[model samples]
Target: MRRRAGVGAIQKHRLEQEKYKEKGTEIQENQFQQMSKQLEVFRENLEDFASKHKSEIRAENALNHMVREGLAWVDSQEPKETLYWFPSMFAECVSA
Candidate 1:
C-alpha cells in the first residue's frame, strides 16, 4: 500500500509538471507572436521614413558634406570599446 501511494504521488507530480510546461510554452508562443507583430509595424515605419528621405540621401553635394563631417567626427573620437558592437549591430541591421 505504501509503495502504491508513492507511485501515485510521483504520477501526480509529473502530470502537474507537464501541465505547467505546456502553459509556459503557450505563453512563450504568444509573446513571440506579439513581438513579430511589433517588428512588422516597425519595419513598415522604417520603409516609409526611408522613402520620404530618398531624395535627400541622393543629393551628391549635401551627401559629400555629411560624409566629410562624419569622418571628421570619427577622426576625433577617443577610442573605446563601443565601436565593436555598434558596427556589428549595424551590419546585422543592413543584412536583415
Candidate 2:
C-alpha cells in the first residue's frame, strides 16, 4: 500500500509539471502573436508616411538624386533600395 501511494505521488508531480510547461508555451505563443501584429502595424504606418511626404523626403536626401540618375541609365536592372529623385541635381559634384 505504501509503495502504491509513493508511485501515485510521483505521477501526480509529473502531471503538474507537464501542465505548467504547456501553460508557459501558450503564454509565449500569445506574446509572439501580439508582437507580430504590432510589427505589421508599424510597417503600414511607415509606408503611409513615406507616401504622404514623398517629395519632401526625396528633396531632403542628396543620395536620392544620385540613385534617380543611375536608375535612368539602367534598362534591365532593378534597384534594391527605394528610388527618390528631384527634377534637377541638388548635390554638387565634388572631385576628390
Candidate 3:
C-alpha cells in the first residue's frame, strides 16, 4: 500500500538520523579524550621545566654570591681589573 510505503520511509529516515547522532557523539567523545591526554602531558612538561629552572636559579644565585664575595671589585668602578669584567670567567664560575 502507498500509505505503508510512506510510513516505512519515515521510519528509515528517523533511524538514519539516530545513527548519525550517535556517530557524532562518539566522535566528540574521542576528541575530548585526546585533548585531555594532551593537556595532562603539557602540564607535566611545564612542571618539569619549572622544577629544573628553580634548581638552576638557586645554583646561579649561590654562585653569584660566592663570586661577589671572592672579588670585592665587582661593585667598584675599576671592575674591569677583576675577573668580573670577563664573560669567560663567569661562564667558568657557573660551569664549576
Candidate 4:
C-alpha cells in the first residue's frame, strides 16, 4: 500500500509539472504575438514616415538615428529585451 501511494504521488507531481509547463508556453506565445503586432505597427509607421519625407535625407537620417537609440534602450531594458514599444519612443522623436 505504501509503495502504491508513493507511485501515485510521483504521478501527481509529474502532472502538476506538465500543467505548469503548458501555462508557461501559453504565456510565452502570447508575448510573442503581442511583440509581432507591435513590430508590424512600427514598420507601417516607419514606412509612412519615409514616404512623407522621401526627398529629405536629413529627416531620414534623424529617424534612423532615433530608431537605433530606441532599440538600444530597449535592449538594455531587462524586462522585454526588444523594441516592442518602439512606436512610443519614435513619437518622442517626432515631437522633438
Candidate 5:
C-alpha cells in the first residue's frame, strides 16, 4: 500500500511540472509574437520616413561622405597652416 501511495505522489508531481513547462512555453510564444509585431510597425514607420524625405536623406548622406573623405585627406597630410582651412572646408561641404 505504501509503495502504491509513493507511486501516486510521484506521478502527481510529474504532471504538475509538465503543466508549468507548458505554461512557460505559451508565455514565451506570446511575447515573441508581440515583439515581432512591434518590429514590423517600426520597419513600416522607417519606410514612411524614408519615402517622405528621400531627397534630403540622399543629400545629407552625400555631404557626410564628402566630409569624411576630406577629413581623411587632411589627416594624411602633414600639419601646416592649410590644416586651419579644414573648418571652412567642412562648412562649405555641408552647405553644398
Candidate 6:
C-alpha cells in the first residue's frame, strides 16, 4: 500500500512539473509576440520619419547650394560696393 501511495505521489509531482513547464513556455511565447509587434511598430515609425524628412533635407541642400553660388558670385565682383552690400544682405538672408 505504501509503495502504491509513493508511486501516486511521484506521478502527481511529474504532472505538476509538466504543467509548470507548459505555463512557462506559453508565457515566453506571448512575450515574444509582443516584442515582435513592438519591433514592427518601430520599423514603421522609422520609415515614416525618413520619408517625411527626405524632402526637407533636399530643400535644405538646394538652399545651401544657392547660398554658396551667391557667395562665389559676390566674391568675384569688385569689392567696393559689393562688399558693403553683400554683408548686410547676407546677414539678412541668414537671419531670415
Per lDDT, the best of the predicted structures is 5
lDDT scores in order: 0.71, 0.73, 0.78, 0.78, 0.78, 0.76
What tens digits encode model 2's per-residue C-alpha lDDT throughout 32-57?
Answer: 99999999999999999999999899
Task: Give per-model CA RMSD.
Answer: 13.8, 10.2, 11.5, 16.0, 8.6, 12.2
TM-score of 1: 0.56
TM-score of 2: 0.55
Clashing pairs in 2: none
TM-score winner between candidates 2 and 5: 5
Candidate 4: where is the Cα deviation over 4 Å? Answer: 1-5, 58-96
Stretches of model 1 off by over 4 angstroms after superposition = 1-5, 59-96
Candidate 3, residue 44: lDDT: 100
Error of 2 at 92 (Å): 12
Clashing pairs in 6: none
Pairwise lDDT winner, candidates 3 and 6? 3
Score every model by TM-score. 0.56, 0.55, 0.52, 0.53, 0.65, 0.51
Give the Å error, residue 44, model 1: 0.4
Model 1: per-residue Cα lDDT over 1-96, one tens digit each: 344558888999999999999999999999999999999999999999889988876764554665566531223254663121124446678999
Who wins the TM-score comparison?
5
**In candidate 3, how many Å is residue 18 off?**
0.4
Cα displacement (angstroms), candidate 4, residue 43, comes to 0.3
Q: Candidate 5's residue-wise lDDT over 24-47, tens digit each? A: 999999999999999999999999
Taking all chains together, the TM-score of candidate 3 against the true structure is 0.52
